[model samples]
Target: MTYLASPSTLFGRLINRTQYADLPWSNILAINFLRGRLNRLSANLPNLIEELSDENLQSAWKVLQPLYYDLYMLRAIQESKQIVQPGETLTREEALRLLHFP
Candidate 1:
């Protein structure tokens, strides 16, 4: 038989693990960063789609390939609890590297 933890149980475990009061603030900042990227993409993608030129395609690829890796990172975050070393903190550049940002 297979066993699966419910979402609330998983969330509870996460809540229990975190001891920082600033975690929510960090989460909000991350969400805003992603939201800004998404907004820019929404604003720009239509122009690329309508134009369909070589330069525009290249531009779109440059903008999107990192986003593709970021999506993978999001999945990894959901499924893996081993992304970071124990008690080791990541710098902003290191985080960008994990996203495969160019």
Candidate 2:
């Protein structure tokens, strides 16, 4: 039997083994790839929904996949350190108060 770790764990292992210097991905290419993939996936969703039966196991599997991918992308962004998560948000007044605190 094969045991699979959570997506975050998988990503951690992958990044640790991967050499960023050898990566072919750039911001522009990544943006374009995501845009193209989103458009294609959006167009296909209706067809996919139509082809799958609600009572079938595949229907529930399809439902979980999108949620998993969303969580995966969010985790990637948070791990990158370039983006902030919602819990990190500070009110404008709170921010100014912190800046001026003696």
lDDT of each prediction vs. the true structure? 0.59, 0.59
Clashes of each: 0, 0
Candidate 1: give its CA RMSD in angstroms: 14.2
TM accuracy, model 2: 0.32
Model 2 C-alpha lDDT per residue in residues 1-102, reported as the tens digit of each score: 111234334434233214564655675467456566665676566677677666864667677778777876876866766677666878899999999994
Question: For residues 1-102, what per-residue lDDT tens digits would candidate 1 score against the true structure?
Answer: 111333333234233214555567667566556666655665575665777978867887798778667866766786666666665777888988988975
Please report, as a residue range, the 10-residue window in candidate 1 with the lowest summed lDDT. Answer: 1-10
Please report how far candidate 1 places residue 67 from its true position, in Å.
2.1
Top-scoring candidate (TM-score) = 2
The C-alpha RMSD in Å for every predicted model, in order, reads 14.2, 12.7
What residue runs in model 1 are displaced by over 4 Å at the alpha carbon? 1-51, 81-102
Q: TM-score for every candidate vs. truth?
A: 0.29, 0.32
